[model samples]
Each structure stands twice: as C-alpha cells, then as structure tokens.
Target: MNTFGLVIGLITLAVIGIGAFWVIRGERVLGYLWWPYFIGAGVLLMVTSGFIKNDWCSALAGVIGASLVWGATEFKEQAIRAELGWYPFGNHKKRPPFAKIIQKWKPPNL
Candidate 1:
C-alpha cells in the first residue's frame, strides 16, 4: 500500500467534504468568488501534471482540477434548481439567499 496513494485518497475525501459543504450551503458564494479559484486550479493541474514526480500526486491534481471545472457547471444547475424550487435552498432551518443572486439570473428561454 503506497502512502502517497493513501494521502491522495485522504485529500480527495477532504475535497469532497469541502465541496459538499460549499454546495449545500449555497453555490452563490462560489459564483461570487469564481474564476480565480478555477483558474488557479487549472494552472496547478497543468503544473502538477508536468512537474510532479509522483504519479499519484499528478493524477490527483488533474482529477481535482477537472472536478472543479465540472463543479462550475453543476453549481449553475444547482442555482437553476433552486430557482425552479426543485432543491432545498440553503440550510433547512433558514431561508436561502436566493433573491439576491438568482433573481438577476434569468435563464434563456427555449
């Protein structure tokens, strides 16, 4: 059992926990603070893919970076779902900050 692999798995789990927290609380915070994060992650992905000595580390970076990019799309859909009243908005005990952002985000009509 490679320790590096174990470390990577732990880091991935951490990412999942953080990402889930972000998703559950609300993606508006993410949207408001976007671009820099995804861009940095992309750069990190490329750098790790090229410079990392460990295969697991490089692969982990690539996966994480790609997931971040994909997460943007998922976040958008989550916003849409929230607008459509499909998903629970923010914490179950509190009202979501939906009016602040989603009100201004009108989806294109088909």
Candidate 2:
C-alpha cells in the first residue's frame, strides 16, 4: 500500500510538471488537453474505493485525485484565456474591488 501511494504521488508530480511546461511554452494545451487529468483522477478514485480498509491510503488517494482535477482546471483557464486574448495578469484598467487595492499600492507613476 505504501509503495502504491508513493507511485501515485510520483505520477502526480509528473503530471504537474508536464502541465506547467506546456503552460510555459504557450502551446495552448489547456483548451483541449484536459482529459488525461480526468482519467488520472478517475483511476485514483476507482483504486481508492478498494482501499477502504486502509484509511490512510484512501484519504491520500482522494487528495491526490482532487489535486489533479484542480491542476486540469488551472490549465483549462489558461488555455481559454489565451484563446480569448485575455491576459488577466497583464496590463488593464483596474476594476472596482481591485481598484481600491491597487490604489493603495500605487507607485510614483500612478
């Protein structure tokens, strides 16, 4: 069980690294490449169900599965933003709620 958990953790790390690299490369992987993450999460869930006797394994599996889903979402958001030409972190007029926060941190140029 411990070895299984370790393997899952390593796989999760690999997914994260690959996802991040794609993002950095500006390849727009997020818009259409989300299914592998779904498969990973589904597998984890299916495996965890059989690990009921090992509470620790079950819990770790759930957490790892959820994290993979979240990672896919992150990639998807970036992809959609790229497709739409929307750069959330890029230059833009500050909106209402954030405007006030920005004003507080204004530099000399502002």
Candidate 3:
C-alpha cells in the first residue's frame, strides 16, 4: 500500500529466500550463515517499515520470513544428522538424545 511497506515486504522475502537457498545447499552451511542473514534482513525490514502503516505486509513478511528461514535451518540440521547417521536432530537435545557425546574445546595454550 505504501512505499516503505513495499520495500520491507520485498526485503523480508529476500531474506527468507536467501535462507532457503542456504538450507537447500545444506545445514552446516546454513547454520554458519543463517543467523547473520536473518538479523540483517530483520533490520532492513524494520528500517524499510519506518513507521507501521495500513499495510501490515511488512509484519506478515517478517513472520513468514522468520518461519521460513528457521524451518529451513531445522530441516537442514536434520538432513545433515540423517546423512551422517549421527543424530536425527544433531545436538538439539530434544532429538537423538546424545548428551554423553560432549565436545570440549579449549583454547590452545598461547
């Protein structure tokens, strides 16, 4: 409906799309890249929103965009786990309960 709203909507879609692409590529890559891209997209959406207006398109876009990206992330994680036969949900706790497999990383002595 308004100029800013349209921009926000487009930005949100772009964010979601990029996240999807990352997911489709694989979760390890997505996990490494998703958060930054998501944050950047959210900021851009809010900036383009300027002030809330009649078209709630930006809000809707934000919601859908977040969901899409998050869903993609989850999917990618699961896929990686499945591919590796490690855990159905990687280290997500809720799935493939493998807490015993602790990975302790200490900084090398300098």
Which candidate should be chosen as best, given TM-score against the real structure? 1
Q: Could you tell me which 10 consecutive residues in candidate 1 have the lowest summed lDDT? A: 28-37
Instruction: Provide the lDDT at 56 for model 1.
Output: 77
Ranking by lDDT: 1, 2, 3
- Which 10 consecutive residues of model 2 have the lowest summed lDDT? 88-97
**Residue 108, candidate 3: alpha-carbon lDDT:** 17
Residues 1-110 of candidate 1 have per-residue lDDT tens digits of 56976887788888767765565444544442243345456567767676878787777777677556555445656666765777555433322346455436543221
| Alpha carbon deviation, residue 66, candidate 2 (Å) | 0.7
lDDT tens digits by residue: candidate 2, 1-110: 25876876676677567656544343242232433445466567857757677755665566556555555446545645665777433232213334445346422110
How far residue 5's Cα lies from its native spot in candidate 3, in Å, is 1.1
Off by over 4 Å in 1: 1-29, 32-36, 90-110
Could you tell me the TM-score of candidate 3? 0.34
Ranked candidates (TM-score, high to low): 1, 2, 3
After superposition of all CA atoms, the RMSD between model 1 and the true structure is 7.0
Q: Deviation in angstroms for 59 in model 1?
A: 0.8
List residue ranges in candidate 2 displaced over 4 A. Answer: 1-32, 36-50, 80-110
lDDT of residue 98 for candidate 2:
40
Off by over 4 Å in 3: 26-73, 76-110
User: TM-scores of all models?
Assistant: 0.50, 0.36, 0.34
